[model samples]
Target: MSLDGHTAVPPESSIPPMPGFPPRAGIPTQHAAPPGGTPGFDVTGWVSAKRHRTPPAIFSLGPEPRPSDPKTLADDAIPGWKLILRAALNFLVALEIFMWLTGGALVWALGFVWPALIKAAGQEEFWATTLLNLLYVPVALILVFVFGRMGRWKAVWRRYGSPAWSRLRGVAVPTAGPVRGPVEPVDVWGPLRVVADPGTLALLDAETAQGLVGDVDHQRLLGALERVRQEPERLAALLGAVREHGAVACAHPSGARDLPGRSLAHDLLSRQLRLGAAENVPKNPAGYRGADIALDPLLLGTSLLAVGPAGSGKTTRLTRPVAEALCLQALTGSAVVVVVGAADADLGPAAWYDVVVAPGDPQAGYGLDLFGGAAHADEAAARLADALLPDELALRTESARLALQQIVGPFESGYGRLPGVRELVLLLRGEEQAWAGLLAAVRGSGMLDRHQHELAQRERMHGLADDPGTLLADRLALLDRPVFAGCFNPSAGDRAPLPLFALRALDHPLRVRIALPDHSHPEAARILARLAVGQFLHAAASRADRSLFAGLVVDDASAAVDTHAVRGLQRLRAANAGAVLGLRTLVDLPESLRAPLFGAVGGRMAFPGLAPWDGKLFEEAWGTVWVDERDVTRSLDTSGGVVRRSFRGMRALLEGERAQTESVTTRKVERRRWSASDLAQVLPRGHAVVSLTSVDGTQVPPLLVRLP
Candidate 1:
């Protein structure tokens, strides 16, 4: 990159641009900076290949077994001496305010009465007043100590003090605007802070920390200091590191979304973090205001749900950024990103990921074994059947599941292996001589009675186009399509290896894309999606040990959600996995899954076009709290002349009646924290209400965010 941050790349680049983020103007196709150019420990050993660095602490070379128990770090606490000093300082301030008020009142009273008293006392009175004034200085000094500071003033102030004054509008007063320069993402001195575990902090390699430092010349150093106004954490680090290394160090932190596109790759590839601020808003520190648009991964037992209209920026703004971040994570050995419906182009570039499995792209040559993934043959069969099940066959889910198990059971016994799509289709159609062998094996194995009923039912349905041929053709159309012709056709010749369900892949840091044909064959796309999602969930749970952070990014989730997804929704986090699911609204989900799915995700962003029922789901999932607000109203009216109105009022009073002349009213009102209607249609374009969950399971108030 040049000092101005424009990237360099070759013209005939194979790397594709992200969906919404086509290569920006002047952003040449390019490769990322070398691993040594970034601040992170090497994680090359963790991945299948030495693609990148930045390994997890426990994942590095160590005989120490990974600890299963969670660790907690104690919060920073104010020392007793500091607390005492704070109290003393507060007391002195109160004493000063009291003395000023008392002095002002006494001066005003004396000025009023001095002339009358002086006249009454004459010359002797004047002398006496002069003597009294001479004594005032000593008296006031003693009173200042006795009544203001060392007396019951503290108690008195406490009894009448309005703590709300600081919070009241027009009293404490807000800043004219956001600070002109940078502010902390979160304050070091803020009351609420999550103490990061020592292990987490130790992940930072001090030797390579300099890579995180950027353009630290005198001018840049001054510029960075000018921007870092209140981040004590960063300030201390820079100062300490500079002292330790005998070199001044500083990093440019962008205040807005003005960072060059390549800068994103720097943060991601650095391995210190998976996300960086794509765009930023100015800070308002007094209140928890402004946007924290950091691209945080939904892993570590958390997930993200972004709901918005079809054309809304949920994909461009939310999903794309997250997918990009996960791709970086996958490179750094921190995450395994399994994205469905998106190819190298849909996300960022193929080089960003270690693997790209495009099922429909014939050139990609990635095939999926229809039944080899699950720990049990039963589950594998069930998931494949569910994916192949027709949308209209709602009542036949069980029957389809049974038919799959029967076919799978006989074939596995006969062939001693799970069948690919082609082989399974041939066997189910009863055209292959292998079917006779499979049936004989099932009967010999004494499973024939259990499978006969379902097999008969399937045969009866096979005669109909809606059940058998449609199911076959729906997927077969994708297989037959010009784009995916030879890739999935095992019967045609040789087959590429299908690695979708490999358990070892879970712990392996790699980016895999399950690209589907969504536009041409929607049902076929849905079928592939359901199967992929289910397998990811089941494979995640089957991991022998918790190691890598796995993530699934589904951009068109409305079509993919199924029974397995619902079952895996809440459990994925525990399995050391996360998913970013996108859809129009909760209305698209089944009623039973709606609430659970919403509750399972740790992050939710509701953009415009939220329906009423969807709003209710968000409302209930986010829950509600009673907030008190003053409801003020005013009225203006023409009334009778002053005397006439007064006479009528007096007469009514004498007659024990009421007169109406009220114009203003103020009353305290309680309402829901965020009403259903607030999300349904009230939010403006580019604005959304979000609910974020902390690692400790704390629910934050629905945050109002302006999408960047």
Candidate 2:
């Protein structure tokens, strides 16, 4: 419950259960311990409380923890005078009780009760003296016990007087455990039973129920329930279809849960992946202050570029969560996710992906398609050139593209296929035997006559001293080493290489993970990363079917953000696709491409320990917002009395400042959303400053967020 007198409803509990399907006996339910403890604890009750259970919702982290809002010092404050007064009052009350029980009893006994006792007894003086003395000691002792520091009277007096200790203590009370119920398994089928026919629900068994609960998306389940409620007749057939096939019948290609383990938290019904919580700062937008910082493909489709240094929580916090969300979305048949990272990077469990392209791993199960499955020679040439050309040689990108096209076009035309990495390198070197064989083959096929003009241009460029082919060949040779033998070969005869363009052809969700050869071939690894990114951008843009949300997650995009890749990133939102590019620093990219890369992506994240220079890019990209500025000034009190003025003059003469003067002024001013220094120095560990833009163009200003 909130302070507004209305209950703060949980998202899942907001949906009204129609009817039917009471919780089964073995269905798990969690319970939370009641708040606070007595002076003496209930050891048995506390220990017996359920400590752990299954998660309540499939997408949530067990339950929301208690908000640790700091308590105000004023709430528990007691004035020094009140403290003294309360102690004095308790002493007085205890003395009064002691006096009444001892002295007052003596008087009462003498006046009434003792008169009758004296008449009945013989020695009145002795009896009265002994009884009165005994009463004094016993009464004083009893009163002392009752009014002691840890006694009931002390607590009662404190509650009754100026320093009410119990009420003050209540302000900072701690709970024994979370104030929630047992973790009930997410009731996926309960809603279905209510809307659908009883016989339809009867078709579901324990296996199917568990499958639906774990694998099927909650939103898809709700949509199905809504459809069945509207047309009751459809329930039977729908249930019957899935009963034999299980929950995967409605899921994407592979209906089973892909990841062996989950680390980050999620809430899939709203299609939002929890990243962190926005900080409560005045500069933050009204609705976003202290809110859950989350994003879906809609926000990501605009593309997200995260800049941070190593160990800045970029991979563990941002990249992993986004990849996991997309993978989960893939299970629902709504998205295609491709994660590219170093071999050792923990993006997710390998089992989560259908294809794992480990280039140099001897035990690798799959290989990469260098051409991105491009059928056209020109398309493959452009993608390859973007990948191989270094940022220094970016000026010759066009020449390199055309240069590769000249070789790749003729080879494919003559040999009926594109050249592999080793073969392409040999051809790019302009070896006599390689060119002569190709020329003869093209002539035999009559390609030489049809493409004579293109071949003539290729020969003329090949003879130049500064030909782009030499630069491309040097870069291409990096991948043709013995370490990468049979890596880029499509016809390796053992495993079929997965292509980037495969995303376009899939109706169901597809997950692909490409692990680069980072250790043995560091430079080659960067080239591979860049190649995969460039190919992904082209393949995503050219997709004939854009129904599935296409997402690319690059754990370390050190060499991927070229001018062409940046331009391609800008157009992804319209294609219903997105890319998450993580970089250790902006220096990993060309200085010229930095600003353009920031501008291309709609979502920008600056993680902790960011360099001041890198933060400036984010600062400039985020721009400024209107804020209230305060100014304070102080001046001498010249209009006061003679004594006050003399004291002020003396103080001013001694200290070189006026003692009694003050002023404050406030006005609206424009300030940077996050200053470079603040982003560099003030950002906390496991936190980042992010600005988001949704697919529909809903903009969220840069705000500090504490990563979950």
Worst 10 residues of 2 by lDDT: 1-10
Alpha-carbon TM-score of each model against the true structure: 0.56, 0.68
Off by over 4 Å in 2: 1-198, 205-212, 215-240, 373-375, 490-508, 632-663
Misplaced by over 4 Å in model 1 are 1-287, 291-300, 342-345, 432-434, 437-482, 492-504, 633-668
Worst 10 residues of 1 by lDDT: 67-76
**Model 1, 1-708: lDDT tens per residue?**
121122211112222111111122211122333222223322121111112211121111111221121110000123434434444554565567557745565445555767564354345676756754664677566755643432234433332343344224222211111111222232211111122223322212233233332211222323333333366665444444334332122221111111123233223322322221211111111122322323344333467788887876777666666666666454333557777764432555554444456666656634554543477778878877777764555456776677677667665665566665566666556554755666777678777777777656655665465465335434534444445544442442444543333423565544566777676666667777787887787787777655566788888788678666767767776777778888887767767677777766887778788877777877777664543343444343336798877766644433223454454554555455556788877777776776655444654456565655
- State the local distance difference test value for candidate 2: 0.66
* Tens-digit per-residue lDDT, 307-338, candidate 2: 89889999899888889888877755567788
